[model samples]
Target: MLYLICSVCLFSQSTGGIGIRATESRGAVISPVTAAEPKPELSSDRAILSPRDEYSSGGNAKADRGTVGHILHFSDVHLNISTSRNDSESAAIPTVYGKDAPITLLVSALAYAKKVLPKPDMFLFTGDSVVRGNMTEEYLAEVVEKNVKTMAKYYATSDSNKMKDVTTVVGNADTNPGYRMNLTDPTTEENPQIALIAGTWQDSLSKADLDLFKRRGYLAYALDDTLTVLTLNTLPYSPSHEPNTSDVLDPFGQFAWLNASLAALQSAGQSCFIVGHIPPVISSFGGSPMWNETYIRTYKKIVGQYSGIIKAQLFGHVHSIEFRLPLSCSLGAQFQRAGVLGDDAIEDKADLVPLFMTGAISPIFSSNPAFMVWDYDVTTHDLLDFTVHGGNISSTSGTVDWQPLFKASQEYGVSTLKASEIVNFVKRAETDAKLLEEYYFNSKAQSRLQSDCQDATCQAEWLCSLYWFSTVRDYDACVAFTTASKSNTTTSTTSTIQ
Candidate 1:
């Protein structure tokens, strides 16, 4: 009812009757402009800076009883520095994805976030602060220090008395795990490197979280009395079982910890916001997801059980601006349907939550470097709206100025930050000529300048790859369908965080 009222007053131009989905928080319904549809795909899954009590104007004044809160979210900065050693492995592979982002690009992006978003309550960096390469501890140290230093300049105050309003989780690349490295022609070493990250990031984490993060590569801290930020290490090497041994990549261990953590938060009457690098959904682009099915199902069940307290999920491994809906079935139900909780499992539809994947600062894969800023309700911490800031780059010209591409509430004509509205927008863009063109060019770095999209077919294939948030399977399906429908029609078309 509140959303409908706000939608009419704010988005007066919208047509037809509105459909609303009520959040667990009473009187808070995310208004969906479109009707609810059965979502067949599986769902997927921050920091305390400034204590919760200090949320009101940095504790300068009592936060208006129900004032709105704002925060900035960015990810996949893949900051790659070059080594002078020409013969070294890191030197040989000059880029990951396409080209590693130069430090200047990252600087510009952060400057832009600071300028536009102003003083956000907190800054959330999903993961992958460093690019993968020949990573000796010394080299890794340099990488971590540079990133942390730069981030501190923006997120932290000069005095350093207060903990910075920053939260970072570990990415697969950050740890330089064995499976991620190339052995035959090794670029980075095949070893666990959590210590390098933890030690380097020590000052950024909360005092209580420092030891836990150093030991487990995951940590949780309260942002305020009402909200707790849970940061998880979704990397392959984040040992799955307790005692966290070297042998298994047990998502069970991660889930067990998460379950306990959520219970604690719920008991405290605090809501949760989870941050991680990998998403739980099956990918067709890369091989399989980082986590096993058992882990995913159990994770989803826990999220569902505490859905009342969980606010949002943030991720960035894919380096695209995308979202995954919440889980539909219980872990047991999904396990029963799929037989084994592996890739074969089917994800149920319903009880959808929002999983947002922020775009990368790296110009890899021709994606436009971009970032997002969100407006949220301080009382409920509900994401009210978001805007994508993107920049163009040229191999010859470097990066252009950053600008806002679109705002969700204004452009999409919806009030609430619901998964359905975003999904429907992406689905509609498939046929909406103007929107499809915009989506394709902005999906990757320097896409606007690239000549790869030779024709309509190329455009279609690429759009399909990006369609529905671009999991590996989604990409394969897009290519297949584009190829099959190649002769159908004719059309062609075509930022920076780093």
Candidate 2:
């Protein structure tokens, strides 16, 4: 278990460190461009501090900038179980494939998280918690209840064995078209989660069935004027054109209920943490024009419609952290977005410049499965800070340590942390893709060379040795090495609401 300590020392209330650290926010720092503008009151604008406050993790010289709410979020847990009929045969099990194993890694991640921070106010588990979103057929009461109990029981923490008054949301992989059956249909059956609001079954549960889940009882264990947690369920496969699918799937009736709930809290000056499966839009995964944009537009329509009350949207489907604060009309968390960066199948591809988007819990990901612990500041009532502990998630932590994950990544597939290596590999392939194979020939006879040359993998490596020898610069070889990498081959497909 890779334990993490997200230790926070609130030495001085005023000088919370986030501001100074955010010097990079505006890109390079400059002298008091002008006297800093007076801090705006909550009435004038939304809290400047983000949830899981990044701006609060101050390095700022100035103290007591203002009050803020903090949040610690986890998303995209594609947790898998040995439910596949294919798994009935031991030969089909993954241990023999020489590929990365999932069971041990996930256990390690869980153990790591539990070993760390004592507790967090609320734990948010976004969709895809159940791999394939098809744990057991709804008709099989024993199977359905067992699956729900196992899941809730599997990742639970706290004396209550609850992850948090955890606000859970549904993800695409959680349910699909064929998998869905009408909530009221005679064939439909339901198994209650210990207590959490998620689409009864991703797509399988229509909006009404989901609404029924909400109405059956409080989705949140504790709900009152003091706190309001909204668990919204938006399916992953809704078509691009319909923004109001909620009316059919689950009526925005829940949304209206949320609006009223938020109003009551707002009127009382109480704060709220609204969690959901999907974050609005940075762009859909592939930058599909319609995919993310529709969601963004729909999110705006609903949030804007309730702008008077709702505070922020918390979510975890992307499996990556995103601290997005819409400059126009902020919709989500004050902290933008955040996720623990390293986990199986997915590496926290981070640009340290703005790190929130890099962290998220990874279960059934890259090779490590982990979760986070958030310390909520009771004094300020803000999610102050969080620490991510890798679950029995060592690329080898269970049997080995981090090294095995890296080694396995190379043998089975590249680890996410090896982005630079991936870039290089792709670029090398791009030359071939571009039909520039003439650049190198593997013919042993034509390329015969001295032993040292033979020791080099390719002409490119030998060229490097020549440069080190200063015998010849081989400028073209050197220049190609640098220039080929300069051009970015990857495209941004994510949608931006702008």
Candidate 3:
């Protein structure tokens, strides 16, 4: 295996094994590090991005053979430019409100990502930059333009809160429907995609992205080859059961061009990394599903056509850390299980493809608030390794002894709830759920419950039951559990996306 030297900065310690997981990626397989086990709980989702080819009706014509090494990404900012923000820490539900903190939080996290990681070669902010997509063209234009403009001056910056260079995408929130870059949220929305291509944001010299590159906090190498990133304005709403003509550019368009691009890039000894807002498809969770069966098939066909050249995928939409496991994934599989399609495929290529989510930047709960790093070896034009740094936004405002979200990421081994460390945690969540249930004692509730508490009549017993349930869904369960019996519907009225 060839090792490429990529660094966010001119300086970086080797990630090669004997100490961290880098060793495994390099060669040596070390035993999993054991720690005070956390309560075993249900799992969460991960996301990824891709672009359409010449076949789509929308513009994103199939890209040429292009690969940019080492890209760092963050998404679903819901920056709360105003006071409103994305909602509570519940993936099962939507939340919207005035957090009054996400703004500062996102800013600080961006600073931290720059301060700690090898200054990235390129920084990508995936999407949902604002709290809501529905706004006046003026509000949309002002918000997107102003914020994007300021981003260069401050994001991932720190000359005591300075700014840095960043490349951005037009997330669904960044535009009106049909690829429209709201001149201010236009009343007459034209084909948005074409509008953006023609907008001032695209001017190459120092428009917005340029001034950012001049910042000193972090740096990136401009690949000789044009690296293409595709941002899809997926849909207006999460309509159940398949998308419509309004969704894609053209049937012969997006996917078709995608295949051709992969072929072209590979033929040129180049690689392609897809970056978008929604994951293209995901697990059963639906709503802008990340990667579904159709996606998997299409992806494999395209990558296979290109001779397996995609190196790493950095994304953020979902707040937690999740990697889309390879198809037919069974529980209790190794990290590479999802990376490799099968044993034969593993034999074909020893490397595991990158599918990383940059966690959240906003101070919203659930996410520990963080950014990511991409150490690309300029000489080899290949990414050497990647790591995630957890952080918080509050430090900017005041001084509190706070640590990043988790001491450790990558929850290993399928948790059985029978594990000693998890038993109490599960019970605790269930107990909270019980208390939540009784709060209403009479309204609508979360229906995902697997079992009901038999001793619910006893307040003590009910408390324990609710506690057990709380561990899995966070407050969504609380809000849902209470809904059945309570008149108060305000528990979780905020939409996480606004």
Candidate 4:
């Protein structure tokens, strides 16, 4: 198990500081200037605060500014095309919010991303490349190929000489077309072998990653000396994606592999970012139970063990900009509840794992289609901020226009993205009429930024719907937290509402 302890700590009403020190780097920083108004020519590009200004602690007066790398993160681009089986003009998922775009609209969104956003050092896709969950093997192959080719086209170099390498993981839809519960079963009946699809993933992933995926459906890659990327194949863990038979081979042993990979990075003094399609949510915002109890327990254990080293956990498939907040209990408490680790083994370590839910590029069920740009300091692996680019998809109009939404720093009023900050933002928003109103209006895609919330009760439910708190007790705790916060505005009790 992973453990870290800081003998000294400072606890605040709104936030708590675990005595983790920030590492300093002497990199020369050139402050980036921002225009007073967004560039009209490229509305999709928003001026954001540079890391030097955003993360400056009241330290040295004249130290050089820091430089950091950026990541282009997007997922669930459910590309729909006419097929022999289905002649659907657009791919729309069944949901109160899901309303997706066809191929042309998707192309326009990608074009805008290419022209407006900063050239990223790395590109990440959390999966779901195809629109239809069920399709023939031939159709599935074609869809994956097209999805990879299209992304390659947009992120390619200006000279068109080199294509930026992409890091990706398998979504439920990517394994076999349509919804087949027999993914774990090969001997029972006729089933599309996942190996066939896994073979096709090589074009999108690195050579080493391709090998790892072929061997065990998961892989890890180091972005630089500072960041290690871990990709988990969560398809098997999802019952909706892979149901029954229990024959799916765990050749590489996902749990053991993850532990080993994370241990290696920790030993090397490197932080990490984990990418996956299905997040470990016991119950979804839609009130549907997703993961099996066993899987949830194991997943939480891994997260608990390495919570300190992981910089961020990025996932998609929920099709919204959601976040998983930190839990209040120490690892020991969590394990004691599970009856895994005893009270004697309890280490009162603070876990700060933040799971960022990236919205879908496909607007299928949702009114807005979106993508994210994660901005963080490379030296410290601190996630400073991120920007969401979303577009309005109209059935009548043939074209789609994309623009930037608010920045995390500007909206949340916090330079660092932490669980406490997010919790406080929700707590305050529940009581403050303006903040509550804005929360609902902005939760929608940039294209659908209108107030749908009728009252505070509705707004509170809408906000709570974004996270999977695991147990009924946890959910009730959040409701109580929000309710209590309304009465005592000055109380600074630490929240465990995940």
Using lDDT, give the best candidate's number: 4
lDDT of each prediction vs. the true structure? 0.53, 0.32, 0.35, 0.56
Candidate 2: worst-modelled 10 consecutive residues by lDDT: 1-10
Model 1 ranges off by over 4 Å:
1-66, 84-97, 157-164, 177-192, 237-252, 284-290, 326-350, 394-397, 423-440, 449-498
Candidates sorted by lDDT, best first: 4, 1, 3, 2
TM-score: the better of candidates 1 and 2: 1
**Clash total of candidate 3:** 82
Model 1 Cα lDDT, one tens digit per residue, 418-465: 654554565555455566555544445334654544455665564444
Off by over 4 Å in 3: 1-70, 83-102, 154-166, 176-190, 193-200, 203-222, 225-243, 246-252, 284-288, 291-300, 328-354, 363-365, 376-384, 392-498
Q: What is the TM-score of each candidate against the true structure?
A: 0.67, 0.47, 0.49, 0.73
lDDT of 2 at 107: 42
| Candidate order by decreasing TM-score | 4, 1, 3, 2
- Candidate 3, residues 1-498, lDDT tens digits: the string is 101111111222221211111111111111111233442322111111111111100122212213323445666666545422123422212222223223445555556544443344456776656545455555455555545544554444334421233444445455544223212112223334324322424443333333321211011222335333333233321222133333432222334444544444555666555665544334212212343333433443343334245554555555544443221111112213323223332211212243445555543433344455444434334443233444322333431122222211122211111222222322333335443343222110111211343332332233222221101122123333333323333232321110
| Candidate 2: stretches off by over 4 Å | 1-74, 84-103, 133-163, 176-211, 214-225, 240-252, 289-295, 301-312, 328-368, 383-386, 391-498
Tell me how far the alpha carbon of residue 213 in candidate 4 is from the true structure, in angstroms, after superposition.
1.3
**After best superposition, candidate 3 residue 26: deviation in angstroms?**
40
| Model 3 lDDT-worst window of ten | 22-31
Model 2, span 336-451: residue lDDT tens = 22221113201111111101222233333332333443434333444333333332322332342311111111211212212222223233433332211221221110112212
